[model samples]
Target: MWIPPPVRAPIGGAPASDRRRVCARIDRLVSGGQRQGWPWPLPPSGPLGVGRSRVRPGALSVGMRRRRPGEPLEPGNAHQTVPPLPRRAPRPSFYWSDFNNVAREVREFCEENGLVDERRLPSATELRFMPHPRPWLANGIRRHGGWKRVAERLGVRTATDVLSQPADASAPKLRRRGGPQKPRHYWREWKNLRSELTKFVCENSDSARYMPTVDELEAHNRYDLRYAIGLHGGFRLVARQLGLVARSSLIMRWTDLTAVAAEVRRVAERARLPPDVMPNERQLRQYGPRGLVDGIKQHGGLSVMAPRLGLRSQRHYPLRRKPRLFWTRDEADRQLKAFIQQCGRVPRVSDFLDAKRNDLLTALYRLGGLRSALERVCAEMDIAAVQRQDGVKT
Candidate 1:
């Protein structure tokens, strides 16, 4: 509040308030606010109010009074300088000079490391150690033409130079890292697998003990034979190699037709029919001609016997038409809708197939495509009941 008595002129001469207003206006004008027409609250009426004042144009109107005589300037006083503005980084350009420099550095690196004239190019691991601002040899080679052209331009030998030579050339071979690789099939393991299969066949050839159905094979704890068959070609070749039965026979064991013929003749003689004559197809389908049908049934079916006896299968017998075993279309759709309601979601085609209902597959396709049919079924299905049953929101 201690303004010099000269600055505090009472309401007429320049007061301290008028001096502050003038100084602020000058600062704004100097800082380029004049073009914006930013006006000062106090007009440029000089702090003197009427006469020409000592305040310089566009300068802060401070200390207009003359300094008293014989006062020395302070020692710590120094001129202030504005700090230099920071410079920006230069952007890169794809100029020939830059490309040439990149090429030269890469060529030198290749030559020094003995990679320039070799058949083998540097591995990714080796390339990682390339010097800074490396031009990344791989990227450079790809971008500036290719390896051959870049190398030719640089007067360096291309990687292809060594490769183009015959295999018998004097260039040393690239040794594999980590020593020799093991063979794919372990010889001892294969041998053991073959021995085990051979022993199994010899022991169980007469009995069907070792003959596994596809499902059984999948479920079995032993994977030896399966692995061997898969590793080698397949079942037939492996079985043939091991001197077992033919692959077809392995799938469905062949019947001894001569033994079957003897059994039929005995059954016929016991039934008091001519020893050579077999029962009619009708008789075979019925309670199976008493003893004969029951006996054949015991030994698989009359179908198996008919084949052995050099007769057509009784299965193909043109008897009275039986009722259709398959579900009708409406029945199938009903079942599907019922199932979807029960499960709370449409079932997959695989679900139908796995259900082993070939009829259902037929009916679904007949109604429409599987997805469309399921959509239709789902639309009709009682979703609310399904949700309630499943204890989840639909």
Candidate 2:
């Protein structure tokens, strides 16, 4: 009952020797298959050889050990699972211009259509984006002859549609040409005439009060006569008259007048006087004209009242009436001597007073009666010195 090799057996329906050989072959095939990394378990009907028989229709025993519940399975010698590849997006169509073809087509179209008449034909600039059917396709018919023709065609239809249908009818009309040139010379003449008229008006008017002298008038004209008059006269008729001008030319020269007016304003502002020396409304009402002392008292408050009262202006307070005394030259001299003896030295005078030596001396004499007093003191001192010398031992 020894079996032959699997190679000697037929595929199927073979003899016992063949069967034995098949069985031996199957064994050898299985062994070989295992070595070659194929699934095990040959079909019973097949010859015992590699790849000869199909296995059971059930889950094929791929020589892969079954994974236990919750157990990790070993990798088989099969192709790995791969993720599906991503799809690419389609590209957009682009249109490129062929200038040569376009130009040739345009020339041909112009020749064919008798559009060579410059006046009737469109300008080169207007022909931009002109379409040619031949370039697009030989038989492709272009609705527009060129850009101008297309525009014209569309414009007519668009205009018709607009006219037929109601819309916001207030859209502004299209201007066909550039606007008018600015009037430069007219403006220049107008300004010059205005200035000359302003001068004439200022000088010839008799109603002008405080007519500035020639120098004054020139100065005012240079700056602004109207403004000066306005500032000085405070809206006088003269100022108003100068400012008003009926002529366009005069009106144009108003800039010069304006400049003058500005200068006058500046001068007036600079010349403005300081606040009044009189008391404020509140103070005047509260104290009245005779309330100078009271007003001073109020301003000084109680803290400063004593010093203010002691001031020279307030000296009449203690004295019933201002004192007056008459003194002869000898009496004045004696008094001055007595005053010098009491005070020790004459008072120092100001530098300005010292510079006017005679005036300072006169002032000192008049104010203090020092001149006569000094004379009397000198006489007495001279007698005393002589007496003292006599008393001293020779």
Candidate 3:
């Protein structure tokens, strides 16, 4: 006994013979049995026969003519029996009807079984009979302006719906947290203290006295008052409000030293110095505050005072020397000898001067004059060779 070949299922899951019979019925229904005047080429079979004919690849048999490239399909030549081409999904339609009603059904279903949980939405198994079910529902809602709009039309409150509600503009904004509120009496005290401080700064601020130092303020018990003003804004602003010029630093005014220097110039003129010579630090020191010495040094030193008095002078500050090389005389000699041995000859004076070991060459010159140093090194090389030979013989 032989095994028969397994019958291949027809395209629509029917037997081949059954498919022929079905196609015959469909063809008769589609073309009304008399296809002589039909625009499309019919199957090459008898009027009522059930034989199926295959169209050649890329050659559609239509309108009794071969469809050529670039030729548009004639209206009457559309393939009535050919399978439809696979098309991509169309753009979502915004005018979907009954969106509210469909959404209502879904919302009711979710609420009925508490299936509204976003992390675990109701599965499609429960909605098997519904057309397109949850996926189509979501797409339709999205197409018709989002889930929030759908929820509003269905009279349901979803997370999306709640979030979509506009915030009330009339609501008061919350204040940012900060330090504790200052007491009412503390504010009153602040006003009075600031006024007094202003008056004090105006009276004391002058070219002669300038702003009081922190130490001086501490003596008068106004240091804490200054700190309080700083916490509110800063001392600079308070001083500015009082029409007092703020100094860069608390210790001294920029012009204070210049004024003192001016006084020293007057004293110098009285000292009978020649008109062309400005007084130096040693001469200017005897005329004013001892602190003036350091101030003079900072403001480009005593020479800076010369130009101001229309006198010519020059500043002379000490210059630093370069450090000495690390190598000793014996080490330098060994290095020089090794260099001469590698080079196959002693270096010329100019070559030695140009080398990194030029300092060593300078030392060699001092030890035994330039020409004499080369003679000594050549003599040492000969003696070392003789000693090596004697050691080998021993």
Q: Rank the candidates by TM-score, best first.
A: 3, 1, 2
Error of 3 at 300 (Å): 2.3
In model 3, the runs with Cα more than 4 Å from the true position are: 1-195, 202-261, 270-272, 294-298, 314-394
TM-score of candidate 3 against the unseen true structure = 0.22
> Of the candidates numbered 2 and 3, which has the greater TM-score value?
3
Ranking by lDDT: 3, 1, 2
| Top of the candidates by lDDT | 3
- 286: Cα error in model 2, Å: 7.1
lDDT tens per residue, model 3, 1-394:
1223433324345466765664455445437623445433333344424333332211121112233343333455445334333333454455356565556657765665444553222233333322223444554555555544555565654442223211223222223222222233343455765666666666654453244455445655565555666666665775555555555442353247656557556656866677676666666667654456566655655566566657665335432222456455676677778867866765665566555556666666666654555556778887332222211111
- List model 1 lDDT by residue over 1-394, tens digit each: 1113333223235666766675565445435544655232223434334343533331324312322223222223233222233332343666333677556657565565656555344332344533322335556555665555565666655433433432322334333332121233432466866766666555545543343333334444345456656677766666566565443422242245454456565555555665445655454444232344445554656545665676553244443332465556677778777666655565665565666655666666766656665655656763322222221112
Total backbone collisions for each predicted model: 0, 9, 0
In Å, residue 142's CA in model 2 sits off its true spot by 99
Deviation of model 2 at 144, angstroms = 99
Better of 1 and 3 by lDDT: 3
Model 2 residue 73 distance off true place after TM-score fit, in angstroms:
99
Worst 10 residues of 2 by lDDT: 57-66
